[model samples]
Target: MEFMQADREACDRLLPGLRERLLELPLSELESADSPALALFREYGGTQLLIPADRGGLGASALDAVRVVRVLGGLAPSMSVATAMHHFSIGMLYSIADLYGKDTEIEPILERVSGEKLLVASGFAEGRSNQGILSPNTVARPVPGGYVVDGAKKPCSLSRSMGLLTTSVAVPRADGTNEMGLLLLPADTPGISVHPFWSTFPLAGAESNEVRLTDIFVEPTKILRPPPGLTAQLSELEEAGTIWFQMIVTAVYTGMVSRLAALVLERGRGAATDRARLLMAVDSAAMLAEGIARRVMSGDTGNDCAAAALVTRFSVREVLTQALDLAVELLGGMSYIQSTDVAYLTAAVHAIAFHPPSRTSMTDALLDYYAGKPLVMA
Candidate 1:
């Protein structure tokens, strides 16, 4: 009946020894740019957690993945944020493979991901302000065999350590229009480079830098095009991607807040009622995320599920924000002045509001969906 004990045990079972190793390091080191958390994650087979067991991977359920992410967020916020991007991209790729079967050109690459433990970084428009989540910032020019991609993803997580870069691009058609497509390229491919971008100290270890692709040539097979005639609105793949992104990212932040809640209880910072409220806030958010994961596992990753995921994410955001404030207050000024852990985690938890489909941007869309219209992300 301990707080988050089941999830902690799940983390131990899924990625044995990672939590202990991460705990052995100081929080300052674990949150810094030079942190070894990502390396330790890869060494412990963290990359294979979502690749499906039959495909040479763990094939963890959506619920298990959320639990594992919650544990990681508590230990290393940066690693959880960076790996969320990786998992989102992996989920999209593997979903495509499942729909199309073994003939996918990306099948071997996926095999490498599960078999070799390669990390994939997502380059979606989520980082850009006032843009549709499905919009492509990176441009791709059609060539004889493939495309010469040109653009950059500022604040792309896992930029420094990713083995593969999967990005959304606007591909120009011969008929004088553009279509959204997903492109997969090796991280070391010619003309692909990473540069300094993320300047904030919090989550600095995530390597959220600018990844510039200057005329990087990719083969035709490497680009995943949406089925024809679906350009006017969100595609099924885009829906799934959104759901996965929102669910996993929410879980990561929830875990971060859970850490603060844990500290509050351990120190017995307040009266019985106060302690119960703090734990309830954090646990409620955790359960909301789990609800979305259950929906995904039930094969309902369409517009309704996507909307539910967004609702859960924003709801958790409100709940956790209050919980964070309460935990810090209960911890008192002495704890704040004596150590940086409370301050650091509080700042990190605020980052949940900055993630994609931000509340401000999604307000009108959500209203329309509530009025019985389809959920739209534009």
Candidate 2:
């Protein structure tokens, strides 16, 4: 808890500098599909925000990380979305071992991350089609000395700058079933390549492209496996990573809505009621998500965390959509102008629901939770 507080403070302390940098970038370039906003963000040591203090990282708690991303989302939506991949990956990698009691050799990588300030990108599966981010899309074939992983993660963020990739793959078990295993390796390993895939202008800075791994060899030391009966226990680990991803990604969009609300305050009239309503709604959504994060950090990963995250994400997306509508309606005709930032922001806000654990999946999961059934989404 103390460490979490410290991380929160570190984020707060750096918010001003991040905001300033975003303001300095030109609106046109910032909206380009090939923006340098992320490059500039890294120059400010943003890569270290989620690293643990023991490993020379910021030791940011879930709350601290959320606050940082929320603020950045407003200033630079693409950068925030891009970095959320790294932060959530770090969150799971740093905490999962301790939670599950596996001495996964991750400290060396964490040390390298801290000392070298290397950026880590996520190749975790996301969205409704993926079902769950932990469900490995890649396959790991066992060999004499190690496993050969072959698959690809499309729309992988931080494509150009990441020095390492953190992902999971399915390994066949002797029991005629497949179990999930998390893997980490250097991004520059032979047979690993990044390709251009993202074309969305508002989010171009995220550099979300395709990362292909072709028969990449990984030793046992680089993989973390659950104890016996992984199928029964897989949900615990999956929820841990999912909660972290949903929380931070939701915060990223909240930051955008926040900026839109502030704009209403600056340049609108006769919309005080609407502005107040929007701000209140955004805050409520944020607080609800924060409550869920606190529980997950406090060691609660049962149906409660999974259910809350699904609902919070659903609610946040709805709130943000409404807020964006109010923003345009309040700002009047000027908002439609192509050159204006509001137009770009409005477009970016719609991409929130497109993230992961799609509405269909969450709806099913939420119903199961309410009906007192095992909280699993197929």
Instruction: Write the residue-wise lDDT of candidate 2 on 140-220 in tens digits.
Output: 989989989999988889887788898878988888788778887788889789898987677887888998999899887
**Candidate 2, RMSD to the unseen true structure:** 3.9
In candidate 2, how many clashes are counted?
Answer: 0
Residue-level error in angstroms, candidate 2, position 56:
1.3
Show how many residue pairs clash in every candidate, following the order shown. Answer: 0, 0
lDDT of 1 by residue, 1-378 (tens): 899988988899989999999999988999999889999999998998898888988888999999999999999999999999999988878876666567767788887888779999988787676666557979988888888889988889999899999877998888999888777788889998999998888999999999999988878777777765655334687788889999999999999999989988998998989999999999999999999999999999999999999999999999999999999999999999998888899899999998888898889999999999999876
Residue 219 local lDDT, model 1: 80
Model 2 off-target regions past 4 Å? 1-16, 99-104, 128-131, 142-145, 173-177, 227-234
In candidate 2, which residue pairs clash? none
Candidate 1 ranges beyond 4 A from true positions: 129-134, 143-145, 227-234
Error of 1 at 112 (Å): 1.0
TM-score of each: 0.95, 0.88
